[model samples]
Target: MDDVKPKVVVDPSAGFCTGVKRAIATTEKVLEGDGEVFCLGELVHNEAELERLNHLGMKILDKNHLSRTTIGSHVLVRAHGEPPETYKVLEDKSVKITDATCPVVLRLQQKVKKASEEMQASGGSVIIFGKASHAEVIGLLGNTKGKAYAINKKEQLDSIDFSKPIRVFSQTTSDQNEYEDICNQIRIKSSNLSNGNPDIEINNTICGQVSRRGPALEIFARSHDVVIFVSGSESSNGKYLAGLCKSANPLTYTVTGTGQINPEWVLNAKSVGVSGATSTPEWLMLKVAAEIEAMI
Candidate 1:
C-alpha cells in the first residue's frame, strides 16, 4: 500500500498587489537599461526578491546614503513613496529619480496635503491611523509639513486635541475594520469635546486590494487543515495577513521562503494552504506548496 500525500493548495488571492507589481516592473525596466539604478528603500519587502534584483544590478540606498552619493544617475522610489523633502533633496543634488510611488498613495498624499492646507489656518491638525515610522505614513506626513500625528494603536487617539478641527487618513495597507473604528472613536471624541459641533474630516485611504485580502485569506485559511503563510520578516502586510490566517486556523505557520518551511508543520495534515503577503512573489508560494507536497 502506498502512503497518501496531503493535498496542497495555494491561495489564488495571495502575491503582489497592483502597487507592488507596478514598482517591481518599473525597477526591472530601469535595471535593464543603463549605468546605475538605486532604489531608495527595499523595492519590495521580500528578501528573496530583493536578492534577485540585487544580482541584476539594483543598488539599495537609504536617504543618508543617497544624500552622500552624488554620482547615481537614477534613484527609484519604492511603492511606499517618500516625503516631499526626499524629492527636494534629490532635486537639489541633481539626481534623476524614477518615482514608483503607488497611485493610491499619491492620491492619499494629495488629499492629505489639501486637508492640511484647509486646517492650517484654523489651528487644526491632521491625524493618521498607521504605524508612525512606516514608509507610507512617513510619506503621508510629508504632505502635512510634519504637523500630522500617527496613531499606531487605538489608545493613541487620546493624544489628539479635539478642540481644533481634525482631518484623518489611513495608511493604504491598514486594516479596514480598525481604521473604521478609529474614525468612529475620533468622531465620538470630537463630538464630546466640541459640544456636538465637531469639524472632523475623514478620508477612506485604505487600498481596496489590501483590504480585500484580509477576509479572502481568512476564508482560505479556514478551508485548510494547516496553512503556510510566506512573507519576508520585514514586511508589515505579511505580518498582518499571517496573523489573520492564524486567527482563522490555529495551525497556520509563517515562512519567508521554501527554505524556512518546517517539516513538522506539514506532517499529518490532510490539506495545506499556501498563501503569501502582497510583497510575496507568486512563484515563491508555488515553491512552498511544492515543498509541502514533497514532504507528504
Candidate 2:
C-alpha cells in the first residue's frame, strides 16, 4: 500500500509583525549604505534571518560587546526598544544610531515613563507586569529609573504593598490573560486595603500585534489536521502561539527550525498547517513548509 501525503496550510499572520517589519526594513535600508552597521541585538528573534543578515555584513552586538566596540560606528536599535540612557551612551561614544524601535513599544515606554513620573511626584510606587530579565522589561524599567518592580506571575503580585498607591504597566509582548489576571489581583488587593479604595492604576500596554495572535492562531489551528509552529525558543510570543496551536489541535508541534520536524507527527494527517510568531521570518516558514512537503 502507498502512503498518503499531508497537505500544508500556512497561517496568514505567521511571520513578522509591524514592529519587526519596520526593523527589517530599516536594517535592509542600512545595508544598502556603505557603513558597517551593527544591531544592538538580533534584529528579530529568528536566527535564520539573523544569519542571512549577517551574511550581508550586518553585525549583532550584545550590551557588553557594544561597550567594547570602537566609537563613531553605526548601531541600530532592535524592535525591543532600548532605554533612553542606551541612546545617551551611544551618543557619548559618538556612535551614529539608527533607531528601529517598534512604534508600539516606543509608545508603551513613553506611557510607562510618564506614569512613573506621575507616581514619583505623588509619592507612589510603580509596578510593571512582565518578565524580569526580558529586554523589553529592562527597557520599561529604564523609564522608571530602575525603580519599577517586575512581576511575571500572579504570585509576584503579593510583593506589591497595597498601603501605597500603585501605577502599573505591562511589557508589549506579555500574555494578555496573564496581564489581566495580574490586574485583577492588584485590584482585589487594593480594594481590600485603604477602606475599599481602588487606588491601583493598571495600564493595558500590551501591543495589539502580539495580543491579536492568540485568537488568530485559534482560528487557524482548527483548519488543519496537524500544525507546525516555527519560531525561536527565546520568543515568549512564539511559545504562546505554539501553546495556542497545541490547545486547538492536539497534533500540533513546535519546532525551532525545519530540521526539527519529525516525520511521524504528520503521518496520517491530510492538512498540515504552519505558523510562527511575530519574530519569525516568512522565509523560515516557507522552509518549514518545504520540509513538510518534502517529507510527504
Candidate 3:
C-alpha cells in the first residue's frame, strides 16, 4: 500500500506587508548601483533575507560606523523610521539619504510630533502604546523631544498623569485588540481622575493591513491540522502572529525558513498550513510549502 501525503496550503495573506515591501524594493534598487549604500538598521527582520542582501554587497551601518561615514555617502532608512536625530546626524555628515519610511508611519510620526507639541504646551502627556525600545517608538519619542511616555502594556499606564490632557497613539504594528483594550482602560482611568471629565484623545494609529491580519490569520491557522509559521527570530510581528496561529492550532510550529521544517510535522497531518510574518518574503513561504510537499 502507498503512504498518504498531507496537503499543504500556504496562507495567501501571509508575508511582506505593504510597508516592508516598499522598503525592500527601494533597497534593491539602491543595491543595483555599484556605489556603496548603507542601511541604518536591519532592512528587514529576516536573517536569511539579510544574508542575501549582504551577499549582494549591502553594508549595514550601526552607530559604530557613523563616524566613518563620509560626506556624499548614501544611507538607506528601513521601513522602521528612525528618530529625527538620526536624520540630523546624517545631515550633519552631509550624507545622501534614501528615506524609505512607510507612508503610514511617516503620517503617524507627523501626527505624534504635533501631539507632542500640543501636550508640551498644555502640561499634559503624549502616550505611545508600544514597546519602549522598538525602533518605531524611539522615532516617535524623538518627535516629542524625548518628553513622550511609552507604555508596553496597559499596566504601565499607572506611570502616566491622567489629570492632565492626554493623547494616545499606537505603533503601526501593535496588536489591534490589545490597543483597543488599553484605550478603554485609559478612558476609565481618566474619567475617575478628572471627575468624569476625561480629557483624553485616542487615535487609532495602527496600520489597517496589520490590524486586519489577526482575524484572517486566525482563520487560516484553524483550517488545517498543522500550521508552520515562518519568520525571523528578530521580528516582533512574527512572534505575535505565530502566537495567534498556535492559539488556533495546537500543532503550530515556528521556523525562520524551510531548513527548519521537521518531517514529523507532516508525518501525521492530513493538511498543513504555511504562514509567515509581515517581514517575511513570499518566496520563502512558497519554498516552505514545496519542502513540506517533498516530505509528505
RMSD values, in order shown: 1.6, 1.7, 1.6
Residue 102 in candidate 1 has what lDDT?
95
lDDT of 1: 0.88
- Write the residue-wise lDDT of candidate 1 on 66-121 in tens digits: 66657557888999999999998898888878999999899999999988888888
Tens-digit lDDT track for model 3 on 59-81?
88895578888888889988989
TM-score of each: 0.95, 0.95, 0.95
| Better lDDT candidate (1, 2) | 1
For model 2, state the Cα shift of residue 248 in Å: 0.8
Clashes of each: 0, 0, 0
Rank the candidate models, highest lDDT first.
3, 1, 2
C-alpha positional error of residue 156 in candidate 2 after TM-score superposition, expressed in Å: 2.6
Q: Tens-digit lDDT track for model 2 on 26-58?
A: 988888893468899778888888888898879
TM for candidate 1 is: 0.95
